[model samples]
Target chain A: MSKVLVADFGTGNLHSVMTAIQVVSSGSEVEASRSARKIRMADRLILPGQGAIGTWMSELQDDNVRQAVNEAVRTKPVLGICLGLQALYEHSEEDGGVEGLKVLAGRVERFSDGLNDCGHRIKIPHMGWSKVHQTCQHPLWSGIPQDTRFYFVHSYFARSDRDSEVAAVADYGLEFTCAAARENLFAVQFHPEKSRRQGLRLLTNFLNWNGEV
Target chain B: MPLAKRIIPCLDVDEGRVVKGVKFVNIRDAGDPVEVARMYDRQGADELAFLDITASSSNRETILHIVEAVANQVFIPLTVGGGVRTVDNIRSLLNVGADKISINTSAVERPEFIEEAAGRFGSQCIVVAVDARRVPDTNPPAWEVYTHGGRKPRGLDAVEWAKRMCDVGAGEILLTSMDRDGTKIGFDLELTRAVSSAVPVPVIASGGVGELSHLADGIEFGWADAVLAASIFHFGEYTIAQAKEHMKGRGIEVCEIIDEFE
Candidate 1:
């Protein structure tokens, strides 16, 4: 049976990630764990984070999950969501410039304060559903159509240095990299746990993947 | 396209079952909350709200179980409210997979709870629900805040309460018009506009969404960031797609649904 470990860094909602994994892949054993030993033993790792960047970084340090996460990403499949995706970058401007894990060569930047395409002033959190355009073929996007709407709630987004690592792009004020993949690591800015059927499909794909590029 | 206006389906739960009633009386069992939530998720609902109308101490565990069950099946944002008086209560709900927690009576009892909860958890996870009624025969014809499921009048002005909630760090306001609720008219446009413009945060217009056009009115005229409905979606009157289509026709930018099943 596939064993999936959802690494809990003590910030944001991790329950939804565990529940979604359980529902989508019933045969797999899913555990929302903070223990480094449990994380290392799992076949797949899900790094889920939320809230302020500096606070999440401090909690990750306090829990000593950084080494465990790095080892897991090198040896097995790793998926990041929301702040999890943000943490994979080099740094973030949130909370006065907090440093990230630097797993991916990119920086997280906040959306510019302005109006949207329709000339209506949008909220900062960008809380709602939006379309995600698949930029390339990836196993995670299997069975899900291009430009499917996914639920997003965040003020900052990722900017990758290498364009090829961008698996999907979404438009808010402008097109931004919403999903990134490098070797065994895949991450998304949207909450797949809250994206409905399409989200479930993505989780199912992740469960079936074999840690390939 | 702009950020799509959200369409939320609210489920009023009593002892683990979805129930609906007029003014919180003569309640009728609708269905299981999990099944209803799963159906709405499949129907392309943007989010789901579960309100424990019976917020009795004995039923607290039951609501949590319902939330857990729904969270397992529904892959969407779930907001749980009622009987959430303390930070521990919010923690318990979030631990069970709730994305947001709505506070009404408790917030009205202690306005500082809004700041405390928002401070502990980010404001994005805290929702302030305000149930208001339009008071006629007054010089300005203002709205009064009601607590205890709209049974008690707190005498707080609705617009001012919304502003205070925002100032205290409420991410969004779920403004429900008691007079328009269950009356099948529409949202209180004036109240919605007043609160939406008063705060920098988003406003979710609730109550009295009778038809598809009413949903559009909530965004176009009421200036709501999201429109919430119950009876119409709970029954077979209309679907979320129909509402989105109507809103799109009215020049509102709605999230496009790419039906993969078809």
Candidate 2:
């Protein structure tokens, strides 16, 4: 049995998230831990978090999950949701300043005033159900159809110019990165678990993906 | 660019359990909130809204237990409503991981609720749910907005009420046709277009939806941001994948579906 580690320290939807994976892969072992550890025992790792970056960082520190996550990401499929994805970046300006896992070469920041200048036509926090624009080719989108609408709930978005890492995007007040991935690490700004069946297919695809380029 | 139509599955929960069917009379076992949520999570449901149906009058606990349980298991965004009358309720739901909260009866009975909730939670977190029934097209004709699950009529024009809600900071509107709900004869497209055009906030066309094509009509022709239905999904008439496929073929942009099963 391929063990899938779902790292949870009282953040976002950890159980429903595990249920999503379980639905696709029959049943995989779900371990909710504040301190990430023992990746050798699992085939993949899921990093799920919901809430502000500052709070998540504090929680991680309180439980010492940072180093354990870094060690596991070295040779595992790690997926992050909402703040979980943000935590993997270099840093965030959510509250004062908080440094992230920085496993990837990028930075997460808040959306700034674009050409419109009035800020985003959409309200701040960019919450709601919006559609995503597929910007790149990645196996995570395998069975997924084009121009699909995914559930999104967030105010700040990640800013990455790596080009190669961005997998999908959505336009609210402006076009922003919705999905990003690198090697064994994959992250989406949108919540796939909350997105229903299409999202489930994405999870199923991820579990069996094999990271085909 | 035309906004893509959304196929949403709504779960009406009573005391943490999901109930379904027309006029809400023939309620059947729709599965545990978390268990059913897992299935929809896999089905690629565009969005899921859980309505407590009686959370208000009963003054029962806001049913955050299911929210906690379901949010823990599902990855997609979750919007919760039903008896959500105050900003604290919205705060509690969001703190518990709900992406958004829907407000109904409260908004009509007291328009201030819309402004207050939107001001405190940000317009994005507030959704105004309206139940409208067509009451013959007179000089102005008229559509009455029903509150308390169609038990009481607010005696307000549906279009006017929608405009008022938007003006007061409603980020989105969940509009349902009382006559068409559960019948699945098709969506009240006429009503959908009116509400969508009247407000800037995204409008979710609810009440009646029979087929995937109906979903297309709701978004394309009806101009709704999302389409909500229960019977089809509850009875297994069409899966979210099939509905999305139908929409995609019609040149609609749907979220990607990673098909690993086939």
Candidate 3:
């Protein structure tokens, strides 16, 4: 059984993700911690976050979490969800534009105003579920069909420097990257824990994944 | 596909058990909240809302426990409503796994509470529940905010109130048409369209969903991003998958996942 450490950088929905990880992995030990020791010792790491980028960044930078997360990103298998995915980028348009974790090459941009789909005004935050299309093959995409809708609640999205890094994309008036992947690092802009069976399937895949692209 | 319109099954909890009060006059025992939530989740329910209508505030801890149980098992966004007054209440619900907190009476009483809650908890988690009743004898028909289950009027315009709620940091508005509520007819399309058009946030049309056609009308004609119903879903009149199927037949985008897990 894998020991999964969900890096809780003082964010919301921490328990939701923790419960999901445990439900998917029968014997896997899932924990929420800010301890660098537990993070480094865990077999897998899941980064879950929400709310503003300013606050999320500040909390992550405290208690040696920033340093610990960086180390885990380089060596251990790590997964990011929602705000966790945005933090991977170099910067974000949220909170009056704040700097991100810089783990990947990208910038987070807010949805442009007055976007219409067939004359219907698209709301901000892009709340609710949307279909995610797999653009590349990865272990995380296993068992999940292409265009499977996942629960997403966000205003800003990631714009990667390279298209090859995008594992999946979802549309909300405009197509945007929903999942990004690299060696030992995979992140999604949707809440898999809040997503149903397919979401649980994705978490199961991640638990069984060895972080090999 | 764009973001699929959400279909939420609202369950009213009273005294730690699930019950549905049709128009707040006839209360019927539905089932356990956790079990019902699981049934909906397996049936591809987009989301679930637990309205704690437990009159006695002493049993407040009951809904929290129920939400915690469901959140631990069910893998979908859960919204808890009915009697959310303070930031502490919002924090407690969110901490117990409520993806969103729906505010109705408190939001109408103190608009500043929405601002404070949204500021402290982020706008994405705050959902202001607006109960709108159409004023009688109006040329084009205007609606006003009514609290206490449409028994009292807050003297505020429904459309303008929705706009104000969004302006004060509410991420979404759960607009219920008091005039159409419990009527088998349909949603107040005029009221829904007016409010949805006025606000930049997503609006959930609620309070009068009788059949599958009403669900479609709420999304297609009313311009609501989501449709919430209780009676049709709680009493076994319709399942979520069936509702999605009916909505999809009408060209509305709805989400359904095929489980590939062994």
lDDT of each: 0.85, 0.73, 0.87
The residue-by-residue lDDT of candidate 2 on B178-247, one tens digit each, is 9888787888888888877666667888887888888888877777777787877777777778888888
Once fitted onto the true fold, the runs of candidate 3 whose alpha carbons sit more than 4 angstroms away are B21-29, B259-262
Model 1 C-alpha lDDT per residue in residues B131-233, reported as the tens digit of each score:
9999887766699999998999998999999889888978889999999999889999988988877776778999998999899999989989999999988
The digit string of per-residue lDDT tens for model 2 on A1-213 reads 777777765554555576667667775666655645454466788877665567667766844466667766767777888887788778888777789888666777776533223221333345445677788778788877777766676767887768787878888666777888888778888777766666777888778766445
Give the lDDT of residue B59 in candidate 1: 90
All DockQ scores: 0.58, 0.16, 0.71
Task: Tally clashes: model 3.
Answer: 0
Angstrom error at residue B108, model 2 = 2.0
Candidate 1 to native Cα RMSD, angstroms = 3.2
Q: Per-residue lDDT of B1-262 in model 3, one digit per residue for the tens?
A: 3689999989888888787632321233236777788777777888898888863579879989999999988889998998889999988888888889999899988999999998887888999999999899987889999987678999999988898899999999999998898896999999999998889898999988889999999988999999999898777778888999999999998886564532
Off by over 4 Å in 2: A1-150, A154-174, A179-188, A192-213, B1-4, B21-31, B56-59, B95-97, B139-142
Name the docking class for model 2.
incorrect
Chain A TM-score from candidate 1:
0.96
